[model samples]
Target chain A: MMKSRSRWVYMLLMLLIGAFHILPFYLLFTTSFKPIDDLSSKWVLPETWNPDNFKNAWEQANMGSAFINNLVITAISLVFVVILGALAGYPLARVQTRLNKWVYNLFVSAMVVPPLTILVPLYKLVADLGGMNTYWAVILLHVTFQLPLSIFLFTGFIQTIPRELEEAAMVDGASRLGLFFRIIFPLLKPITATVMILTGIGVWNDYQFSVFFLQSSESQTLTVALSTFFSQYVSNVGWVAAGSLLSALPPIVLFLFLQKYFIRGLASGAVKG
Target chain B: MEVGGVLNREKQTERLAGMVGRNKRLHPSAWLNLLYVPALVLFAVFILYPFFKGIQVSFTNWDGYSQTFSWIGLDNYRRMINDPNIGTVIENTLIYGVCSTVFQNIIGLAYALLLNQSVKGRGIVRTIVYLPVIVSPLIMGYIWYFFFQLQGGALNDVVQLFGNQPVNFLDDPKWNVWIITFVNTYQYVGIAMVIYMAGLQSISKEYYEAAELDGASGRQRFWHITLPLLMPAITVNIVLNLIGGLKLFDVIMALTKGGPGYASQSISTMMFKVYFASQDAGYAAALGNLMFVLISVFSLVALTYLRRREVA
Candidate 1:
């Protein structure tokens, strides 16, 4: 309900916000594409797009092995996070017993426990358990930290499925386990997508936990590898930018394609807080 | 329709809750609750156990390695209090937590409001704003590094256009913390915008129309109708941002490495350096406890305060 003149100001503001948000990425793109010797300002695209930085980054960053580690950790962590979160959510959502309610509160409260607060002991524990630099160790850590949000979301979504769906099946002597597997789990698809995206992104992008726990060269994730690489070669801005760009590509691509789900997942997950 | 949908969801929840009460005894196989055992086991081992262990370690003189370290009684915490950098570290953390929350909410709400209107290309703008949230904060730091790298930074590029001296935005202690907060806000403000947009959308149009009928101006409607109803979203953003910001590590580590002589260290990064660089595990654990206490107290207070003001 604005006049045309005011609408112009409104649109201008929108443009500015858009430009401001994209500026870093734009600068990143130009930097990543430029060669080490190219001394042009970050604003200017190289006269000739050079593949050398990307090639050098791929080699020096140890990206191939790091990619594999990240994939394995993220993939296993996602599976466990989803299954365990969904299972934990079921009775917590449906039963609502005193113990279940307490358990649910435990999961929710765990959300506030910043993982780093326990970093000292967590690292020690994992090290004592001989879990450092192993896939399962980091995987379990990710699953543990991620379960709270997943449980919260799963519980909320399941509660909305009317009780009759289960009760009616139970009257026909459908076993409780049978009921969940046959009737309920399928309906959890939407929330599973949300959980996967939320937790998946988290595990994939995690640096705080991964940097310490996944320390070895063989076990390093993208962030860990890139951090080590970047620090060692801080003078090589083009290489660092390229490595960063390479590391960022998959999530950015996934987000672009699954834009709706990504935004909805973030809003629903956080607003329920 | 919005009211009805919310009411229906609430009623369904209420009815499901009622069923839980009614069927408490009807259902014999309560073993279904055992489904959560696997998850609880992970939590117990990874989270619960380590939490207590962190507290225990805080009281020790462990050097983060070696077989034996003596018990120290509150010595580590006393050291934390006496540590010259502790005050600056804590101050940096609060600035990170509070400043980011404030600016993110303000800017995020503004973006949400603008995009909520009938504008062309707003969809793309919203997508662009949210894109950074998905990228790794470590990567996001490097992306900004190219722009703040002192020698050939983009900020300096723009500075030279104005015939000014090139500035190293990241290296300066005065600007680094604020710049880190800015990057953090930029990365996460999208989430805030989405939450507020959801909050704004859920406010019934009738309230606005009723206020309009009373000749209320835009500002009045926003202050009266919108702000109060949006309190829940505000509470969520504040608590979430506070916690997230307080525990910030990646972006700072990537950008400054808590550098220029611990000048830009938050508690999280500071604790990291203490443990790894200084090999003071006991002090690190104490710092961790302090951070835990800091975050929990801040978020709980904000939650309680905001919850009281919530209209619903």
Candidate 2:
């Protein structure tokens, strides 16, 4: 252990690091609350703590509709991700057939392919499908891209579950699929949470594909809506700030509540995969 | 962790599947593999198809939206090689990819080490560092945007207090890419820290205890014990950051939009400009392919090189 006198230095450094990390956020806090007329520097807190920025940004940015679109897309994408990712991971993890191995590799390799690399044709494909402004188009894209990591995580997690559970279930005359539903699905909750957290956040905060696919004002998600708002009101720093803050509120709130799961899920799902 | 599972996973799965009764009659379990059909179809339609189509489109003379275009046959690729703006774009991409990786890893490792100590307020500090990572990168960039914007910006205000001119951090070519990298590094270093912390915890305290008994200096113990043992974590972080930073689009779009006239254009952002604004979908597709290769090669090489060191 470090000496008591020097330990204070380390603790001080820790607090300094915390302050350093929180600087942008603190600035965001002040800027978002301030009115556009306030000529104060970003370092200063709002003079009167105007709530108009929030109201204006919310209305101008259509934050309500964007929030709903984000929710619908993220929630639906997550459902497909869990169902397809977990189901695919089961055979890939347990069966280990040559075909299964190839399929698993195929799924995992897609993780490295930056989705933007294919944006040129993907955009055209979506447009051709009449999916240009549709939620399903973006939802499917999110589900597809997110599946690789989800499958990878689910496969890795499933491998660790003991075989005895399945073996015992088999002795009681449970079919493989039946046993999967009965035994394996329940054990998947922990890893599923990790998958959901990791993939759900990725889908929720998505901009790359969404920016391309979800172009209409009616279909825009939070990030898209914020970008549209920022470009339209390029000088409305206050409104932009407010919209940015509002859009980011959901995941930030979620992370705060599930801090343990968030950290652990990232560590296990990403690094291990 | 399961990168090392390759050797044992076979025997384990075999034993498990053997007991589960490997059906000899047409392998009934093979039907189970059909569960992935929907996923495979989605991948083929969305990813696999577009990926190949992008490569095909790169060779054509198609504007982003049109029914008629000639097959230019490598003209777009050739143009990319000679394009005036591309040199800066690629350089910026590297700075985003390679430089951000360096900063994130070094800073993250330091934070991990500091937090690994029995320090007060470590947990809260860890949370603060990681909070930015969950926020959208666009919003994170915008947050920093308020701090660095020239007029009435926080940094400028501090400069004025000191009676100095506020530098244009985001607009200057010299500083634009670096600032973008910095913001990105700020957003993601938490992930690296958390990974490194996990690695550090997994390292046995007995190693440090024995090193202390041997009168090894703290520096020597760290270099000899900690760094080597943390190679796995290092590998994961490098590949992750490299891939992430190379494909960085949102932050650059949010911060400078790859501008003050292409000063900070990365391959990702530049591709967006070419495809949408310039309407040069063919050239954008070519750049897209270049990025694909660049990301694949960099991450693959890093993975291989780091994975080797981990075994050693």
Candidate 3:
């Protein structure tokens, strides 16, 4: 009897927690469907569900351009972050030298310094190179910010692999590069996948560097684009709601699809390193 | 004695050299060392050089654009001490950091305990909770900005269903800070929960079994067994959340722009406003340096204590 009562309380608690977790999105969705007239008016349900809000938001925000730009930057950043992180991780994991140790420390310290601190100097650098308004500026910053953490993650995972495999490869006359591509690279698939997902999500969601560096309207990513909606249509409740929802959709979808890997990667990336 | 010992060492050295020569023809340890050069160069260019440049720029009175500048030593640091916004922004950041850290841990640990129940759909529930973490905080802020809108927001709509007036969550100064903290707490609770869950799972069930055999209640077992063991995860989560809160920018930028009179601005947001918006790059860099020093000092003190406790 007591145990059953305890179980009931537990269920109630879980239900409450779940509701809180999902409530903001629920609110977002409902507000997105409301008409401008109904948006500020108190109503449990929209008198008429307005699909036009989405249409207006997409066109006014130029989401098509923003989406393509975001996709390109995120995809390219992920490829570079994963490849570079793995390569950096491999040597740091294998080699024992004062220089390697110093390099490792340098990477670790980079993680602690907040990216915003360097935003001004980086901005100046990009502006000097004439890359300020280009996609490469945001892409490069994302890569730079992500590289250290991803390298740390990859290094931790790499350390768990037996050194015997690489030593054996060396005995078999494989070049260091050949041994890495043949053995270490193939073996690093799991960690690489984790790096890709984590870094991909990070790059996909970045706002600061993107907002600062990519000043051109043509190059505006989804984050900057969604923000621009607010600045342009400051008082348009319907358009803001609709634009907000559209901005959130891709990530929500990505999370749902990669739920298993993302959850694992998040925990491993944080706790392991 | 010295001559005999030196001769013996020379013989050993010759033998070692011959062995090394034999392996050197095959093993490219020296060449493998070169693999790190490209990555190191990239790091120096992108990470190291930029950081030093930031430090150098901090000491100067350069606007981001002009070629001419004078070095203003300690003026930026002095201005930060007298800045009116400094106290309020720091206060807001601390409140946000502490509240979010405490609340996230308490709720997260609870979920971890509850999920450990042999319940169905546990995995699905965990995944659902983690969903928001994958989204950008800027986008999350945009969505919630609408949610907290005084009218036509779902929050207000729901409140009206209960016959209460709509609340101005973002515009009101007091509530605005809490609301900002709330959104941060809301988005990150899942991550904290998942991390705690991992920590919880690592604990052996035998302790619980032993406690049950001793006629302990579920609450007692948890306080004794679960809470103590989860400290490492707690320490890690707390540090991460606190630092994250201190450096928080995007959400603050998108949601309130540190408005309602900068009531909800954090250290990071203030830094941005000063540097980019106000064009006080030197003062902003001073602020950034302050945060860097604070974080380094706190981490050294707190993290060391945590590590020692873990070891004990």
Candidate 4:
């Protein structure tokens, strides 16, 4: 085939694929803008756009509180995962010991195991520890699950950082802490960016853990809140659609801001590494 | 030979001396070992503890709340063996998992190849195509369910335009499985696409050019060069999808709740029902244990055998 024709063919195929991807979002966006009276109508295009649904859904869902709760939990989880993950990864990557190797395997193996397998017992354990219905409880759970993946990825990335830099730092009488904080950590910006974006998306979107762990409305994240909305009013397409669009906005914004790093991180996590 | 032996002896002695000096200087590493204590303790308390506690709680006649119950060892596991509901759930989970994994990978690979072609607007398409994968599955469930709503569903509406009967994709067990698989593929194909695209990008164009020089056609080039080169990504995608399919809960929970008489439930969903909703903590633990074993065995087998084929 000629180059020009191939380009057209490729763009056409991509447009078809884009249609599948865009349709659901289009449905969601359009439905969210529908008037309450026209909510049931399957209009391909909204006859009249209604912005009131957003205000109503936000007020009814108390999404302001949910948004705050989600921010707190995700921010805390991301901070810990990045800081501790880097710390843990540095030594685990540099230290050549039998125990560290075993620990590395243990962490990697945790990835394949489903969180649901341990959910019931985890509920009991948290209740016993008086952590139920608390933001910290959900935050802690998120950190635990996210740690292994971050630590593994960081360790792999850290391996590619040459030891000569650290050796030179040591020659300058820099302490191990100094060498890490000053040299290694700064060198890990790309990997750190990758981890932040990757884990950020995950913690933000997590529902199973958030739903099961967070008991009260006060501590609910966007996903669990949206899920509970579905159960309470299954037929209210306007409210559901409005709530979904609101819930999707933050993550979509996040992905857009970090699109380059997001793709890089995903490539490493899913393909490169 | 004598000179080589003498050099080796000198090197060995030097290595020992360096190790001793390093050991004396690295006393802080022993203290640094305590760094893992927090993570390890958290893992044990949250993950390991819950895993084992489920086993202990399962063998009891406890109602999940009270602190007073007697041991009923082997009873819950025994009951599960004869529970006919468990059979249907197992069948549903396996079929859903296998079908989704196989087809998701195929579709994802196809998209990856298409996206890899040098074309204008590729970046925008990649961004748009990935939008679905990033959405929460429960939300996707609601959206897709609307599109499958018999009379008014977009799917049916389109089908009707072609003069066909509207199918209830989410109601019938047979159709529900297909619908569930479709949703999973829709949600995950983007991930597979991105990963496969990364794999594709890693391959040098020189290989394709060389293949073309030898009079190889598109199909032949793909068969001889692309598939083998993409094996690493294939294994990764397959394992991820398999594990993901097996553990799927939100979509199934949101869409059907293992409904139409337990026709769409997965092992994970079954565990949820028995443990939380149905109040069978002990039996649920047994199911959880079964999942643990199944996942571990499959992962280990894949890592040991399949991963060996990836190029270093």
Candidate 5:
């Protein structure tokens, strides 16, 4: 009887904490659907459900184009980071040479160094290279900053796979590149998934890089677009709430689909760091 | 057979080396070098060169626009020392860092302990708690902005339920920093909890059983067994929170914009203003360099201290 009583207390406590986390999301979604008249008075639910707020947000924020820009940048950056990260990580994991060890350490150290420290000069370099306001510029920067962690994760992962397959394949007259593609690359699916979720969300949700690098309205990513939208519509609560929800949907949906890998990825990354 | 296969491959590599007219025996594949070239070039051009270039820029009088500006040694650093806003920025940053780290660890550990128990609906609870972590901080900040609004905000509505006057949470300077810290802690405690849960799982069940057998209380067992064993998670959590809090930009940008007249400005936000708003790139670089040094020193000190505790 005492044990059951204590379990109820625990359940109540957990429920309270869960409610604290969910309350803002509740407010956001409900507020988005609220009409302007209901926004300042109603807290729990909208008096009249208004779906047009999303349309207003999408059109006014220029989020339609912003979403496409973000999708392109994030997709291109993720592909490059995964492929290049795997290529670089494979050598670091397999080779015992002094150069490889030094290179691996360099990448690891880069992970802790704040990327903002180099933002000024990087901006200058990008401008000099005529990369400002271009997708390739932000794509390259994302790939670069995201590379260190991706490489670290891939290297740690690849170290666990046995090398006998590669060696045997090499002895069977398979070329090294062919061996990697046929044998090693396919084996990297799990880590690739982890890297993709980790770095994909990072690039998609990045604000600092996008704000600094992409200056044009046409080039603005979803995050920048949303921030600009909020400032412009600061007085209109319903529209701003709708904008926030739309801005948050992609990553939240992705997280829901890949929830298991997301937790494991964060845990492993934290443990390793 | 494995050893013979390796030797045979070495011999074939040597034969290939001879055929290529190179004296060195190729053990590691040359294709590996080719694979690393792109990563190396990207790192060199984007990361390596820019870091050194930033250091050089910090000493200059360049306004970020002019192509030609003479180097002025230590001038920007000296100005940073004398700048009145520097003190507030540093103090706010330190408070944010220390408070966020403390709260995140304590709250996260509590949640981890609860979840570690055999609770029903553990999976659902964990998912809900960690959901905010996956959401972008920019949006999280805006979400909380609505919550903290005076007239129709959720927080104000809750306050009114108790017959209390609505507090202006964001606009008031006194409560602004704390509110920011709270929001930061809210978003990130899940990460700390997940990490602590991982740490807790690694502790053997026998330790607790042994402690119970020795008649040690739950509190004693926690301090003696659990806390000591959880040092690694503690280290990671503290360092991450400290660095994250110190370099906080997005949430502050979305929520406050370092507003109410720079009362809640952090070093990063201040640096952004100096560079873009003030057009003083050299000074901003100096500030960024100072932040770099501060982060490096703090991380190193915290790591060493926490690691020593783990050993002891």
Candidate 6:
């Protein structure tokens, strides 16, 4: 009897906690569809559901352009980060050279240092290179910051792959590059997915780097654009809520679809440290 | 016949190597070096070079523009030390960091322990809990700001149900920092919970079974077996939260803007304002350097202490 009662208590507590987590999203979603007059009240559901807010938000806030810019930057940066990380990580994992070991250590230690410290100087450097307001500037910065962690993940993963496979391939008359492309890279699919999602979400949602590097309205990423939109339309709660939901959709959808890999990636990345 | 063929192939490869010369023998590692160039060049230009440049810029009176600026020899640091707002900024930062870290861990661990049980809808519940973690903190801040706004806000409406007067959660100086900290905790507790759940799932069931066999109560089991075994997760969560809290910018920017008379100003937000708004680039660099040192020290100390407690 006591056990059953305690189980009920646990269920109730979990439900409440779940509610707390879901409330903001619910509020955002429901309130986005709310008419302007219905926004100021505590009522969650709209008196009349209105889907026009999304259209209004997209056009007025320039979220369409912002969304496309974010997509382009994130996709490009993810490709580079994953490719470069795997390329660097494979050698560091397999090779026994002192240089490889030193580079691996450099990547690991770099993870602990916060990036904001270098913000000012990095901006200046990009400006000097005439990279200001360019997608390449943001993309390169994203690749740089994402590389350390991606390389870390890749190296750890590649180390687990047996050395015997490479030897067998080599004995079969495969060149060094051929062996990697045929044998090693295919085995990296899981870690590559993890790296893609982990870094993809980060670059997609990044505010600080985008704010500094991509200052022009044409180049602004979703988060930066949404923030500017919010300040401008602060009085229009329904419209702003719609914009927030729109900004949040890609990541939330990605997380839902790749839930298993996302959790596994975070767990592996965190505990190994 | 196959063995002889393999031996002949090895000899043939030796001949090929001889033809290719010693340069060809060094080809693999050299190829690896070529693979490493892109990442190396990017890091040098964007991360490492800027870090050193930031250090250099902190000593000069560079207005973030102009080709000619003289080194002021620690003038920025001197001004930073004497700035009256520095004291409040430090206090607010520590409070924000310490409170958010503690609450996130506590609530996160509590949720993890609860969800570790066999329950209906566990997967869905877990998904819901972790939803906020993927959303941008800047957006999360804006969403929560509605709840804390003075008039027609969610929290104020809740207070009205109990016949209490509405409180200005964000406008009040004393309450603003705490509100911002709570918002941060709300967004991040999901990450902490997910990490702790991983840690909890990793704990062997044998420990619990043995404790039960020994007639250990649930409380005792949790205290002895669970807490010690969870040290690794605890360490990771704490270090992440501390570093994140120390360098928090976006949420504060979206929510309070470190406002109501700089009462809730953190180091990063203060640095941004000083650099851009006040046009004090040198002093801002100094502030950034100071923050870097503080974060490094805090991370080192926390990692060392917590990692020591993690069981082998």
What does TM-score give for chain A of every model? Answer: 0.98, 0.97, 0.95, 0.96, 0.96, 0.96
Report the TM-score measured on chain A for model 4.
0.96
lDDT tens digits, residues A1-273, model 4?
Answer: 698887888788899988878888888787788876773446477888888888888888878898998889889999998887888888788765667788888887788878888766887778888887798888888888888888888889889998878767655655566678999899888888888887887888888898888858888888888888878866777787899889888888878777877887788877754
Would candidate 1 be rated incorrect, acceptable, medium or high by CAPRI criteria?
medium
Model 4 scores a C-alpha lDDT of: 0.80
Best by DockQ: 2
Task: Give fnat for candidates 1, 2 and onward, in order.
Answer: 0.82, 0.77, 0.50, 0.52, 0.61, 0.62
After superposition, candidate 3 runs with Cα above 4 Å error: A40-43, B1-30, B157-166, B214-220
Mark the 10 consecutive residues where model 6 chain B has the least summed lDDT: B19-28
**Comparing candidate 1 with candidate 3, which one achieves the higher lDDT?**
1
lDDT of 6 by residue, B1-312 (tens): 685566456535644654232342453344556677788888888888888889999999988877888999989999988999999998888877888999999999998889988988778888998888899989999899777777767788889879999998888887899888998899889889989999999999999999999999989999899999999999999999998898888899988889876889999889888888887777888888888998889888999999999889
Q: What TM-score results for chain B in every one of the models?
A: 0.92, 0.91, 0.85, 0.86, 0.88, 0.89
Worst ten-residue run, lDDT, model 4 chain B?
B19-28
Q: Give model 6's docking category.
A: medium
Better of 3 and 5 by lDDT: 5
| Model 3 C-alpha lDDT per residue in residues A3-32, reported as the tens digit of each score | 788888877777776777777677666667
lDDT of 6 by residue, A1-65 (tens): 99899899988988898888888887787778977777456445777889988999999888888
RMSD over all Cα atoms, model 1: 5.7
> Tens-digit lDDT track for model 2 on A159-209?
999988887766665567767888999999989898899887898898998
Please provide, for model 3 over B155-189, each residue's C-alpha lDDT reduced to its tens digit, 9 standing for 90 to 100. Answer: 67678779998888888887888888888888888
lDDT of 5 by residue, A164-212 (tens): 7876776687766667788989999888988998898888889999999
| Cα lDDT of model 5 by residue, B1-312, tens digit | 795566567548734654342234444354466787899899999999999999999999889988898889999999998998888898888877889999999999999999888998888889988998888888899999998978788888889999999998888889999989999999999999999999999899999999999999989999999999999899999998988887888888987888777789988888888899988999988988888888888888998898788734
| Candidate 6 interface RMSD (Å) | 3.7
What does candidate 4's lDDT look like per residue over B56-80, in tens digits? 8778877677778789988888887
User: TM-score for all predictions?
Assistant: 0.95, 0.95, 0.91, 0.93, 0.94, 0.93
What fraction of the true interface contacts does model 2 reproduce? 0.77
**Per-model lDDT:** 0.89, 0.89, 0.77, 0.80, 0.86, 0.85
Show pairs that collide, candidate 3. A39-B152
DockQ of candidate 5 relative to the true structure = 0.57
Candidate 1 residue runs with Cα over 4 Å from true position: B1-29
